[model samples]
Target chain A: MSAVLTLDHVKKVIGGKTIINGLSFSVREGEVFGFLGPNGAGKTTTIRMIVGLMDISEGDIVICGKSIKNDFTGAIKEIGAIVENPEMYKFLTGYQNLLQYARMHDGITKEKIREVIELVGLTDRIHDKVKKYSLGMRQRLGLAQCLLHDPKLLILDEPTNGLDPAGIREIRDHLRMLTRERGMSVIVSSHLLSEMELMCDRIAIIQNGELIDVQTINEFTEQATAAFAFETGSLGDAATWLKSDWNALMMEEGFSVEITREQVPVLIKKLTAEGIDLYGVKAVAKTLEDRFLEVTTK
Target chain B: MGKLIINECAKLFRRTGTWVMFAIVIIMILGIGAFLKYGEVNNPPQVNPAWEQELAMQLEADRAALEETGQNNATLRMFYEREIAVKEYQLEKDLAPETGVTLWSLMSEAQAVIGIIGVFTIIIAAGMVASEFSWGTVKLLLIRPIKRSKILLSKYLTVLLFGGLMLTVLYTVSALVGLVLFGMPEQARPYLAFADGEVVERSMFIQLIYNYLLSSIDVLMLATMAFMISAVFRNSSLAIGLSLFLMFMGGTGTMLLASKFDWAKYVLFANTNLTVYFDGVPPVEGMTLAFSIIMLLIYFVVFHLLAFFVFAKRDVAA
Candidate 1:
């Protein structure tokens, strides 16, 4: 797929201090790309730059083949973004608020507005004032707002900042459906590591205004060797050999060792030959949070 | 641009405060109407049959003063000359001073409320841009597929449109109340205006329309300044406070300064009241209609430059 959004060595300097230091990335068509970072990691700053809310100190950002600096209205027309929170006009009803945005665009229809409202499941409360809405309802209205124009790219900063587990799952499902069915690219930033792992197909990890690495979910968690917990009868006379040879960390039921898949069978046979009592074994999976910590620390 | 203006109007009119403002305007007009109608019904100012004699005496006094002054102060001398000419024309035409509150006179009296309209326009202009940031909706407002210049222009246009609306409301209501209380004059009395050092006869309706527009220049300038302050600083109260302060005190303060310094002609308030060029004496001597118009244009361009530059270039971090 072609790149829908590209950031070529983008830099942001505020008050003579560098905030985003030469960061580069691209969001492809029809993929849910995740922006993973800790607090104050320049995630919102980068999103702002992409949406043309802030100027880039250096480099360029191209959206839908249009450079933001050269053709702002043309580039911005292709994007539907929420820079920070989806701060809406609280005094206006949801429908009126949508009308406010719909007027800014060229040819958004009333049916289109209704379609987006229905898509976000806000049809029941769409006529109510936004000030009466809950946080989740506000998020849904915000989602409806961005979807009104059928944009080529959607950039959501901290999409799940104040959502419950159910709300988060709803947003995840909506994003996944939007990508698969609408053929739209999404750049989502979030502090929820587990949520990102479930929601994103590919994730870029950055820290302290610097890019750390970008990897697919499977590659991010997968390593050459895996850790296994070997449950056995106290290794009788085999404890000394097992500890020295495998560099094992002892656990409550047994000991865990890091080894290859091929070596597991070989070690099992040796343990049986030693006449040691053995039990079932299990493999431990490294979660995205663990990998995030490992990558950020390095 | 059309859609943006419509959207802005919807947002502005949907609020309750806007209706409350209109209500206050209507109520104030009625209150003034009632005060004048009931209080003056018992005794009318008896039209002095000798008013032409009185005007002739005043005209003689003004002519004598003009001869004795001998251009000691050019502006004062001009004022004396214009007064003498108008009084002489009033006597030559056999025109008597308005005896009491008439419909046309009440309509002219209603012009005092234009200052109140100016305050309302200032309030609306002051809050137009800053309220977006304060509500935190400027994030959504600026990210659309429109240029920042167009958006700001639409907003400024809407503020002017609202000012027009309020002026219309004031004019219509005052006319209705004035007609109901005083009724039309028995005969059409032509309004004599001093122009080019001579008194000219003009229709009252046309004169009132001219008065409405010329006085609105003051409101338009204050609203523009308030809009610029709101855009550049993103603070509505500061804009409102400063603009309203100037709205009330600017003329008086400029008058005080015009007495002491010649450069006071360069001040913005001194140039806002363009009516002085047409009928009355200018605050500063040697200040002409062309000079004031040029000064107004300079101030206007400066306000727009500051507003647009700061709005289009600044980082909207919040």
Candidate 2:
């Protein structure tokens, strides 16, 4: 996949404090790249810089092969974004707001507006003034406006912030469909790691303005060591036996094990006869949240 | 550019503030026109009768001089023709004072007061542009496929078009009101004068039209100033406040310096009343209408340049 957006050693400082220091990342075409970071980790700042809403103190951001500083119009031409809260003209109807945004782009038709409103599931209430809209509805409208330009890259800063479960699900589904249908790439930032895990193909985890890791979910899970746990008819015996066995294994091959529960057996006899005794055999799968905690903690 | 302008114009029409301001201008013009018409009815001045008497006396004196000379019939006819010419001149002069209170007169007064209305235009213009930022829709605005400069220009043009429309409505309606209230006289006359004693002859309708047009420049300048302030401040209220303060200070600053400082002639408000230049003898020396126009043009350029620079560079993250 071609790189739709690339930031190289980008740095930003405001009022003598560094917000993003030498941060680097690339978002590829047709990839749903999740930018996972805790609040105030400069995720919003970086996104703003990419979308040409903020100036970079140093370094470069390239969008669709155009430098943000040198070719802002060119870089922004195919980029759409919702930085932090989605802001709109409350006095204007949702459709009017969308129309205002659409006018900024060349060649957007009325059908396209209808298409976007439909995509965001706001068509029924599109003519209502935005002041009457719920936060989720406003968010959906913001998404519709961004989509109106048919941009190649979308930088959504905490796009799911403040959304209800249903609204979040709807947005996630819509985003997935958009990517699949239009081959549009998205860079989404959120404090919710689990949501990112479910929605994105790949995720970049950042802490303290530094990108700690970028990995596919499978890679993250696979690399995380699974806990080999078992239970025996005798809890004490299970603990001792497993400790000795796992300790030896650890010494020899670096494999690990732990006792989790005890169960009667047919199990001990069957496991001893087949050389596997502990009835409880469980290996913990590494969830995205687990990996996020480990990475951020580290 | 054309598309942006069209969109801006459409938005202006859609906005309720534009209509509200239009209604205010109409009310002001009609209210003032009505009051003046009522005043005219109650207190019809005495000069009109005095002017008629003066014309009659001039004609009678000419006839008496011819009789005293015992002139022949041909010479008496010559005297009669001369008397007719003097009578025509006197009648034209007599029409002058009445012309000063006609519909054109009210419109000219309205036009002069239109500078004060620039305050309203400034608020409207500032709000029109600054509300986008206060509402935080600038993000949506910039992301669209158009250049930032064009978007800013669209807003500026929209405010200007709205101001122009309001002025047109105010001027036209006020004239109609004046004509209805005070009988529409048959002949139009020039109401203003030149210091060199040269009279500018214009139809009342044309004078009213020019007054509206000329006042529009002040509106345009104020609108541009308000837009620039809105661009920088990004808040409609603050933009409105600061713009008004500056406009007020512009006049005050000019007044304070007009007597004390020779260079005060370069200040924008000091030179705003272009008619003052035609007053023949200027209150201050070395000031000309051409100079005022040039000064105002410089200010116009400066205001727009600041607006464009600040708007294009400032982050719209707010």
Candidate 3:
């Protein structure tokens, strides 16, 4: 499947300072792509450019194979976005806010307004004024608005920000359901790496306005280097023997020993043959957070 | 387009400020009407009868004085002619001319309240759209499916509609108030006169409508200025305040400037007031109704254009 969203050599500068420089990434159709970055990492800036809320200083942003700068409204027609904060009219009812957005897209019926409100689970409170709504309710309403137009691509910035655990779970499940049921592509950016690991099909890590890496969770885990851990009755003897003999043996056998858990079994068997005791063995698997920190830190 | 206009009108009506302005116009008209009538009832204009009688006696004495000095019959005829002219002048002076209707005369009963209603309706008309931005409704407005220019156009029309509604209420209440307070006068002539010699006499109701239309232009100017400022600053109070301040300055700024400078007449505000069109002659020698109108129109167009350009081109991301 072709990419639904693509940024090629995108650069944005404000007041003589570069906000995003030569950033590039693509999200495939039917993919829940999580864009992970720290605060002030230019995530919002990139999202704004994608949504046509700001003019791009350089490079092209293609939404569904259409350039946003050249074909803004046309490209935007197929993309839905909730940027930084869910800005809305405080005085209007939740339903009214959705209705206003509904009018922007052709063929959106009043019935569709009811449907989206129901989808967001805000039907009962849609008539309440937005100003009176809690932050979670507002976020849900904002999601409802983005979903109203039924765009093929959904771009959300920090969708789980300021939400209770249940609210965050609801959004996470809702987004997964949306992608699963409709086969829609979603780009969700957040600082919460664990949620992204759970929710996204693929993820891109960005740091300092640069794309550090893009990989699936499984590939990221599988590509991580295996570490061996070891335990022995005599810690000093084990270290001394390994430093001289095992280190050479493992290196010569096309393996690297880190004096971790995997070496415990080998050392025990070898030590028993040499009349020495072994106690324990262990192996370590890398976590998403560890991988994220590793990639972004560099 | 029609739906947008209707929606704007609906929003306009929903505003508490709109109701407040309407109430102010009505109360002002009624209050001014009652004050005029009460003053009229308690203090009828006192005519100077003594002066009138003295003038008449002087004319009669002049006739007698001229005849006594006549030398020939023809001379006596000339003397008598001069005496008759003197007597006619004195007789004319002795009889008091009928007094023109006062504010009380027009509104004490109900009809005069129309003029006062017209004034406040115009004031309210100026504030309608500017208040929306002041209240931060423009964000909700611009994000809708409609174009930006169309939004402003709808507001422009709504301001006029509001002016019409307020003016209607003003006219009805003033007429009702007039009928109740004072019986309808026999000569129901309109109070307005154009530059043409022809007098445009309207029924009290029609006069109210015409006067409202005349006052609406002031609101239109203010609304346009407010729209420009609202679009530029994107703040309602600033737009309303600046526009109103300019209007206030327009009324008296010229006079103050004239004391210090000879070019006061060139100021835009000094030329914006439509009252001068009704007042006999304008304060400035070259100032005319047509000139003032054209200048106001130019300002209106310029402000709207600036607003449109700024709104369309400004980076909204900030």
Candidate 4:
């Protein structure tokens, strides 16, 4: 896939202290790329730089092959972003806010505005003052505002920050649909690992202003060693026999060993030949959260 | 750029505060008209046939006083001379003192409302950029395809536009109220001004409009200062507090300093009241309209430079 955004060792320094230290990353087109990091880990800072809300001390950001420093208007024209919480004018109605945003870009007709409002599920409350809308409703309105320009890249910093379970699901589903339908790239930052695992095609983990790793969710989660617990009639005998050739630990009703899927049958046959009746065996798979903790903590 | 300015204007007009401010201005104008009308109905100005005799007596007293002490004070001498010139003109023209209400007098009196408009404009200017940051709407504004300078300029221009709108409302409402309370004058009057060591007659309507524009110079500068503060600090309270304080007290404070020091002429407050050069002398000696204009231009450029530079370079962290 072609890259939609590229950060060439972007750096942010404030008052002699480095906030973001030589961060480099690329977001490919038509993918939901997750930026996973803890609080104060420079996630929002990076997002701010990407959206041109903050200046980069060194290096440059190129959007759609246009450098932000050289051609700011050209680079920014293709992006729609919400840096943090979706804060808008409380005095204006949701539809008015959308209209105000629509005026900022060319060729945004009234029909396009209505279409985006409908897409974000804000058509019902679009005429209500934003102050009267709930946080979830505001988020949806913000989404509607960003979509009015039909941008190529959507950068949302902590999109699910103050959302409930249902709200989070709604935003995730909408993002998925947007990517699928429009072939738009998205860069979403969050501290929630489970949501990232479910929503992102690829995840980049950052810690203390440094990029630790970036990989597909399956690769990161499935790298953990798998283990199997065999329930045998003679647990003691099975543990004794497996301990010589394999790493085995005795349990209350079975013995467990760290092995792959292909080793399960051979171990069972060996157990039966050794006069130990094998009742059953179960495989324990590690979850994404477990792997995330392991990787981040290290 | 035009679209950005339009968007800014739309946002500004949508606020409840903007409408409330407009209501306050209209109400204030109406209240002034009512008070004037009440005064006109209750205590009618007795157009005394002996008004010339009374003016002659006052002039005699002022001349005597001037001979005694005005020689040492240039300001007192200038005031006495101008008063004498005005009285002489009224007597020579056989015109009674304009105690009766007329549309011309009402418009002249309504110019005072520009101060209130200045206050309102200052508030709006102070809140222009600062409120965007406070409301977290700067993120949306800056993320657009426009440059940051263009966005900032659009907001500043909108503030000026709102100020202009308020001024227009004040003029229109006052004109209408003046017509209702006092009938139009029979003929246009000429304003007596002391110029080149002699009394000169200037077109009254032209002088009134010029005075209005001159009075607005201070407002424009104060609003610009407030705009700069709003852009640099991004704190509405601080911007409003500092600019309003300067707007109300800066002139008085500078006058006090001018009394003690000649160098005070260079201060912004001393130079802000361009109207002083219209009918009265400047507070500080050796200050001329040309000098004040030059000083104002320098300050204007500096304020804009600081505001734009800081806004364009500063990070929008919040």
List ranges where model 4 is wrong by over 4 Å.
A164-166, A227-259, A263-282, B57-84, B194-204
Ranking by TM-score: 1, 4, 2, 3
CAPRI rating of model 2: acceptable
Q: Best TM-score goes to which candidate?
A: 1
Please report, in order, the local distance difference test score of every candidate based on alpha carbons. 0.89, 0.74, 0.68, 0.86
- How far is B109's C-alpha from truth in model 4 (Å)? 3.3
Each candidate: RMSD to true structure? 2.7, 8.9, 9.5, 3.1
- What is the i-RMS of every prediction? 0.8, 2.0, 3.9, 1.0
Q: In candidate 2, which residue ranges exceed 4 Å CA deviation?
A: A226-286, B44-47, B52-96, B99-101, B112-116, B190-197, B280-283
- Sorted by DockQ, highest first, which candidate order results? 4, 1, 2, 3
Candidate 4 chain B, run of 10 with poorest lDDT: B273-282
Residue B305 lDDT (model 4): 97
Clashing pairs in 1: none
lDDT sort, best first: 1, 4, 2, 3
Between candidates 1 and 3, name the one with more favorable TM-score: 1
**lDDT tens per residue, model 4, B148-246:** 888889988898899889988888788898988887777667788777677778887677767778889999999999999999999999999999999
